[model samples]
Target: MSASSDRLPLIRLEALPAEVLVDLAAGRQPASLGRRCEEGALPPPEVAGRALRLLASGVAERWSLPYAMIDERGAIVGACGFKGAPCLGLVEIGYGVAPLRRGRGIAAAAVRLLLEEAVIRGGAHRVLARINPDNAASSRVADKLGFVRGEVALDDDGEPLAQWLWPPSTDFAHDGEAP
Candidate 1:
C-alpha cells in the first residue's frame, strides 16, 4: 500500500493537538509548506508571524481559516484554507500537503472542505483558484472541487496560469449555467 494509504483515521484541524500546530509553523512537519519556509518562498519570521495573526483574525479579506489534515495517529499531514479576495464577491482557496503525504487524496479533501465552508460562512459568491500552468496537482484539486476554467492570468510572480472559479449558487447543480 502507499505510505499515505497506510496511515490511519482522518481528523479535523480544529481538533488537532496543540503540538502539531507548533510543529507546522516551525517547519518540522515534513510538509511542502515546511520546505517552502526553508527555501524562502514563504515569508520570513516576523512577516510570517504577522501574516498568521492576520490570517486567523476573522477579517474576510485577510482571514485564512487554516486547517490541518490529520492521520489516524493524530499527526497533521497537510493544510488548506481560503486566502484572499480575488474580487469583491470571490474568495481564493489555497492548500499544501506534506511532501510525505502527497497522492493520498488529502489535498482534494481539504479543498472540498474549505470550499464548502467558505461558501457557507464567508459570504462568498464564488471561490477562485489560481494555479501554475504546469502544476497539474493543484489544477486537479480545484477541478475535483467543482471549479471551472475562468481565465488565464499571471500570478504574483508574473507567471502564466489557469484561473478556475466555483460559484456558490445552489442553482449550479441544476442550471448548468454560470450565475
Candidate 2:
C-alpha cells in the first residue's frame, strides 16, 4: 500500500475532533463543504448531530472524513467516506469538495482513498452513491471513480435522481486496483 493508504488517510467517524464537530454543527463550514460532507447545502446541527449519533450507534458503519485539499491552511475543503456496513455487502461513498476546491480532483482522490479503506479494512463488496442529475461535477466524480448507473429515485420535489454503484471488484483508475 502507498504511504497515504498506509495511514488510512480517511478519518473514522468515531475519531472526529470536537472542534471539527462543532464547526460542522454550527454552520461555520461553507454550504459546498457541508454538502460534500453531509449531503446538504445548509449546515444543520440537528442533522449532523443525528448523523453522528447514528454513526456512534453503529447503525451507520461510517461517516464523513473531512480532508483539507492541500494542507492545514487549506479551507475546510470537504469530506468524503463511506456509509453503511461492509458486512452488509453495501457501502456507499459520498463526498463534497469546497467550491473553492472544485476542478482540482480532490474529491476523486478522497473517494479513491476511501474505497481503498473499504476494501482493505471493511471488506466491502459493493459501493453506492446517489447524485442529482444536474450536478455535472459530482456525476463526473462518480464516473471517474468507476461508478455506473444503478437506479433512480424521486426526490421530495418529484425530480428524478440518479443512483450510482461500484463493484468492489472493479478497478479504479486512480488507485490502479480493484476497490
Candidate 3:
C-alpha cells in the first residue's frame, strides 16, 4: 500500500470486477481504466491460462493475481505480482514494463510495492525472483530492491535463471521481529 512518491501505483487485479478480466480476454480495453496494457503487459499466455483455470476451479483466492503498475497519468505502464500465495513463508514475485516504459524505474517501483505488500499483507518472510541470466534490466531491478543474488536454477523452459532473495538473510531483523 506504500509506494514511494517516485513510483507509480500498483493496483491489485483481484480488486477489479470480474468484468475486467472478461474484457481483457475479449481484447477490449476498459475505458478510463489505468493506462492501456502495453503489448505483453498482460500476463504471459501460460500465466493467463493458469489464472483462468484457477478462477474456474473457484480456487483463485489461493493464488495472487497480477497488479497493474499505473503511471502518474493513470495509464497502466506495466504489471507485477506474486506468482502465487506464500508457501513456507516464501513468495515469488514477477514484473515487467511496457517496452516504451523501460528505463524509467517503473519495474523497480512495482517490485518494491510488491515487497511491501508481501510483508504487510501476505506475511511473507522472504520474497523470491527468478530472472533470465541475460536480462540485465531485471537484474537491475532486483539489485535496486536490495535482493541478494542466489544460486542458479533452471526455469520451466529449461533456461538458466539467476535467483534473487529479498531481506537477504533469514537472520535479518524487521520491525522489531527476529528474522
Candidate 4:
C-alpha cells in the first residue's frame, strides 16, 4: 500500500450533481462537476447509472447515494456509498477505485469513512457488501475491516455474489429467525 493510503489518504466523498451522474452514466467525465479527475476515476458507467436511478426514484440523496471519491489534490479517484437508505437499520455499500489507484488502501479508508458516517450519522445499525467472488481485492478489504463472510447468494440479476456483513459481532444469522 502506498504510504498515503497506508495512513488512509486524505480523501473525501463529494456529492455528484445530476448532470455529473448523467455524464458518468454516459462514460464521460463531468465537467460540470468541476474537478480534475485522474483517468478512470469515475465509477463504471453501469454503477453510475444505478446511482442515477436511485436519485431519480427519489429514494436517495448525496448522503445516501454514490459520491465521487476525491483525493487530497482535489481530483476524483473513484466512487463509493450506500445503495440506498437504511431499511430496517441495514444498508448495502458499494465502492470502486481507479484501476491505477488500487492496492493503495483508498477503498478501505473510504469504506471506513462511510462506515463511521452510516453508523454514527445515518443511524444504520448494520451494513453489508455483496462482492463478486472473483474480486479478491474487495474481499480482502472486507476481511481486513472485520466483515464476516456469509453464503454466496444470487443478486437481482441472478449473478452469484458472496455476502459479507459488517460489525461481524452481530448475529446476522439470527436475523433470519422468526421474529
Top model by TM-score, which number?
Answer: 4
If both were scored by TM-score, which would come out higher, candidate 1 or candidate 2? 2
Instruction: State the lDDT at 53 in candidate 2.
Output: 60
Which scores better on TM-score, 2 or 4? Answer: 4
Global lDDT of model 4: 0.79
Each model's lDDT comes to 0.55, 0.55, 0.68, 0.79
Please report how far candidate 4 places residue 64 from its true position, in Å.
4.5
Measured on C-alpha atoms, candidate 2 has an lDDT of 0.55
CA lDDT, candidate 2, residue 91: 73
Report backbone clashes per prediction: 2, 1, 2, 0
Q: Which stretches of candidate 1 lie over 4 Å from their true place?
A: 1-11, 15-50, 53-62, 85-87, 168-179
**For candidate 3, lDDT tens digit of each residue in 1-179?**
43655454433332333445555555666554544556556555455445555567664543545666766656667767777777789888888888988887778777877888888777888988889889999998898889877767687789998878887864332222222
Q: What digit string (tens of lDDT, one per residue) describes model 2 on residues 91-111?
A: 776666656556766667667
Best by lDDT: 4
Q: RMSD to the native, candidate 1?
A: 7.4
Best-to-worst order by TM-score is 4, 3, 2, 1
Model 4: per-residue lDDT, tens digit, 1-179?
Answer: 01244467777887777787788789886778777887777777787788888877887584445777888788888888888888888888999998989998888888888888889888988888889988999999999888887777788899988888888744554442111
| Residue 40 local lDDT, model 2 | 37
TM-score of 2: 0.65
The number of residue pairs in model 3 that clash at the backbone is 2
lDDT of model 4 at residue 62?
A: 46
Model 4 TM-score? 0.86
| Model 2 poorest ten-residue lDDT run | 1-10
Worst 10 residues of 1 by lDDT: 35-44
